[model samples]
Target chain A: MTREKIIQLVNQIFIEQFEIEPDQLTPEKRIFEDLALDSLDIVDLVTGLQQKFSIPLRENKDILEIRTLNDIYVLFEKLAAEHPDIVAKLNKEP
Target chain B: MKPRIAITGAGIISALGNSRQEVYQKLLEDECPTRERDDWADQMYGTYQPFAAAVDLPVETAKTISRHFRRSMGNAALYATLAARDAVAESGLSKEALQSGRVGCIISSTVGSPGEIYASAMAVLRNELQDLSSCQFFKIVSHSSAFNVANFFGICGVQLSPCSACASALQSIGLAYEQIKLGHQDAIVAGGSDETTPIVLESFRFLNALAKNPDWSPSELSRPFAEDRCGLVCGDGAGIFVVEEWSHAQARQATILAEICGYATNCNGSQISQSDGASIAQCMRQALKDANLNPEDIDYVSAHATSTPSGDREEASAIREIFGDTVPVSSLKGHLGHTLGASGGLESAIILEMAKNDTIIPTKNLTRIAEDCAGLDHVTSSRPKRLRTVLKNCIAFGGVNATIIYRLADF
Candidate 1:
């Protein structure tokens, strides 16, 4: 998927799941400090993103590396680039 | 006798209504709010009259909870938090005072989060566990109601969650009363809450305890102590009370609604579902002894007749053996249906209102007394009587029996 599409999906996920507003989606905002999210919340967000993108984010180290919204978008883009299957799944229409 | 634990405030959320005035007025009007559950008929697959008293949740309560945490909260927790908020608001206690170490919280429920439990089990069975949220288990845990209330109020002292089926709420109240009367705490928020879910009804249906009479209207199906009483109609709601020490309430100039002067809890230890009349009588007598009063001292008794044939007969025999036919008796379940864990707290709150207004409410559909339930003054109609004291009884599935005595505050 394109970067713009990835950002849109991430924004929608955060807004709907965490009740976060669209305006609060700054790249510099810390997920834990600014968003007030704990480790358990991160797990839920990861699970939700995985289901949406159909990408496996299995490693705990990768989850730990994610700190900001920008980091999450970058991870999604990287996964889409590495896995053709995920790219094909994301491109499919509803 | 120990020092009296004063009930400074009481709150309820039920199909009947939320405020004391709403429920009390409905009781006096001889109205039953039960309705047909067409949705349940498809789910239960039985002709058993599927009637339930579902709560009309207040809009403010929904708006007050943030969306982020609201998803984690189950209906039981939401009902509990709303009822606790009302009770605390009425107590006139500041948030600082409520969060103080001198206060305690004791809430209970039969199954804390049945919705979450059902959803989680379904997901697992369907191999869709990957879609479940991380907080799913937290919501379904047995202590969700108590923990959610404590978190909502930032209560940090003496938190307890009783899980004794039908007697859960009364057990919580009795525990809170003991703690405060013994000077363990100055005040306590005590009560129970449950939500209307099909699983709750299904459990009773499995026990062959659901009311199923197609000829009778939904309101008339839950006829406690009546000869035609078939079985219990599952209902959902909550009742919360601010139980405080007498001196503490008096010192704060708070309005004392009633004083919980006596409490007794026992177990039949034989049949889990069927209550023994002998054990129930012992519980009542023990409560009277605890209050240092004779049976004649109680002006009214709130019977835990849940419209179940055997349960009503057992409780009625117990009451007759202890208090004879002089004491006016009625069961609020006739109006609210069987609220399970919340029944005792809900009934007790209404009983306090009855004492305050000098009016006794009769059983809603008790037109004819059953053969096994006769010989007692089963309040047939609302009447004005100077009630000084009221007795409340609760019998749960675990062979548990509990009784509490409340005396009116003259001042």
Candidate 2:
């Protein structure tokens, strides 16, 4: 919903699924070189992000231009801006 | 001359226990490992049969494996990797020899985790296939067990994975022996593994082939060769062995456990569901012929009697026609229940123990032998027997029958 929530959820996927450390997941950290994930891991990354954010990301052509962890945060934030309904629903206190 | 095959090491994880000694101890104590699962029936669609089962999962051992490999593994693959590690450790194979490009891997399973398949199918039906885990396909493939075993151990040659249901383990072991006999490889890790999923239990129940727990306790369900014997009780586990060429093992000065003298596998070609004695007898006869030994040379017979009425009858009748009520016969299913694909490797390990310890484990719960399964010298109690030559018979669905012979090799 917010920048902090988006960062928390995206970093959680990297930590849990790919066994990356929290300190290593900086905004400027390159996902491929710093995270040690090869090309084979991109499919799982996309699936994990899509399932987490509840958005269809495969159709998004802009995903090809992504490089760093900050790019992921920016993309999720942009999507949230486009769909205000998700912001309200995700931000509502459970 | 064919190169002799030596079983240098063995490992197993079964309902009875994690090792061959534990399985033998439980069998000596006359304990049954099958138990009831309270949550299992809910998975079945109103077709509950109270199917008895035994499941021994090595959660701690499984956690030790790397996630890169573990992510693609199911229960069967994990069990196999654990067992293979134990077998290799006991063999004391050096890293140089292990990675020398001369070793092979042959692991078999009835199928990949049916539970993963069921879950993936549900995800597909719900139109969430794109969100599925990328490694899900690797876990559900038929060669998952073999590939996982090879990748974990770094084995480099002659990889094979057979999916012949109950006969899978024996077929894999037999293939390993053939590989060594042909001088194609110096050694091979051969075995089979399986997992106890709700679907496997329910499918057996639908075919009236699963043991039920009604008046009797869950432990007393699998009664192989007995008159009131029920059908097979499901159990999950694995068995893997290091089969090495005799010259190679001798050169390495390895501790030889047993010598695989003979192996023969054949298709019944007549019935896919039911077993016939004539074809089973032919399989045994072929193995004996391969070993150049007569029926009398076999001191014991490890039968594939899974507590099913007709299957036991056919196997027993075949034993009578060939061995003729002698050579002390027994089935481990009486204690371990039916391990399906893992039964051959697991029971073969116990048979090696029988030779090494000079203690023959009798068929548990065989209080009174059935009339149809009579005429064989059915062992009813543990006794002292210096087993030299032993034969293992494994019969599976789809008319697959396998027979393997072993001889004690004095170190």
Candidate 3:
């Protein structure tokens, strides 16, 4: 999938999970400070991403390094590049 | 010698209002603030007469609190924390003092996080356990309010969560009084809170414990001792008080609002819903004995009249047997509805409010006293009367009874 599609997917997840408006999803917005997301919300976000992408998010320290929404888009892009089937999986409904 | 327990500050979040001034003004206006909860009633019991007295708490109010404390909180815990913050602020107690764990906290509720329980149950049915959050268990735990309060204030002292149905809040206060009077603790934050949920309301409605008056306004439906009284109207809120030892408060120059002179708690140990009037009367007499005062010394009586036919009559009989028909009595349920666990704490705080103006707030919709509740001189209208000593009563399911005596503070 293209990087733009990955950004759209992450935006869709935030809108669905946190009830955040799409217009508020700035790339530079800090998840914890700007979006008012707490540790609990972090757990939920990681779990949602893992289940939808079928990736082992907790296996690596990648989740801890993410502070901004852009970090999430970068992680998804890396995962898609590493596993070509991930792009095809994202296109299909679970 | 018993240590003197003084109430330094009281904070409340109820249908009436959050501030003392707002609640007092509404009480004087003598209007019932309950609104018809039509959807709740329809969905719960297919009835049209459901009414509730609810507090409006904006999410922004909790923005400043720590995320660790806020993440796991249910509605009851949130309300308790708000009241506790106000009480601590009003008492002039320093943050270091509270954080030292020298102060105790006792808060009560009927059930903890019913909404959370329902949500978890639905998830289980759908086999969606993977999406459940970590905070869900903490919110639904039985001690949610008590634990949340301690965590919020960083209090390391005695923590109690009493669940005695309607008497839960008063029992908490009574226990705090005992702890202070016995010199085990110097100060305590005590109160109770309950979130008005559809399931809780449905349970009460199914048991025929809620009012069903079709013609009366929302305010008039919860007439405590009126001849046409039907049943209680469920309400929600939190009431908290900063109770300190007299010497401790005096040393800090804290304003003493009222002195908790005596407290007594008892149980019938037999029926769950049925009340034993004799047992309740014994509880009151025991409290009077503990206070070392005669029946005549009490200037006012706060009755636990919840408007149910049997509950009101039984409590009125208990009052008549203890203080006879001479003492003036009233119930705040007419204005606030039956707040369940929060009833005792909220009403007790309002009694202190009444003491400020030396005015007795009459039962909101009591037009004619029921024959079963006739002997007591029920205050039907607001009147000015000097209230130096007051007796507060709380009775609940499981035949639990708690009586507390308070005297006007003097230095």
Q: What is the DockQ for all candidates, taken in turn?
A: 0.75, 0.64, 0.37
Taking the tens digit of each residue's C-alpha lDDT, what string does model 2 give over A1-94? Answer: 8799999989989998987779999999988888877665788998888877778888898777789999999999999999888778777743
**Which model, 1 or 3, shows the larger lDDT?**
1
Considering chain A alone, report the TM-score of candidate 3 relative to the true chain A. Answer: 0.90
Q: Taking the tens digit of each residue's C-alpha lDDT, what string does model 1 give over B118-141?
A: 889989899988889888876888
lDDT of residue B263 for candidate 1: 93
Tens digits of lDDT, candidate 2, B38-139: 677788868564554456565677778877778888888888888888899888777777778899899888898877888899998999788778888889
Model 1 TM-score is: 0.95
Model 2 global lDDT (CA atoms, 0 to 1): 0.86
Clashes of each: 1, 0, 0
**Candidate 2: pairs in clash:** none
Sorted into a CAPRI-style docking class, model 3 comes out as: acceptable
Instruction: Indicate whether candidate 2 or candidate 3 has the larger lDDT.
Output: 2
Segments of candidate 1 deviating more than 4 angstroms: A58-60, B45-49, B56-60, B68-71
Interface RMSD of 3: 3.3
Q: Kindly report which residue stretches of model 3 are placed more than 4 angstroms away from their true locations once superposed.
A: A1-42, A48-71, A79-94, B39-42, B47-49, B64-66, B409-411
TM-score (C-alpha) between model 2 and the true structure: 0.95
The per-residue C-alpha lDDT of model 1 at residue B238 equals 87
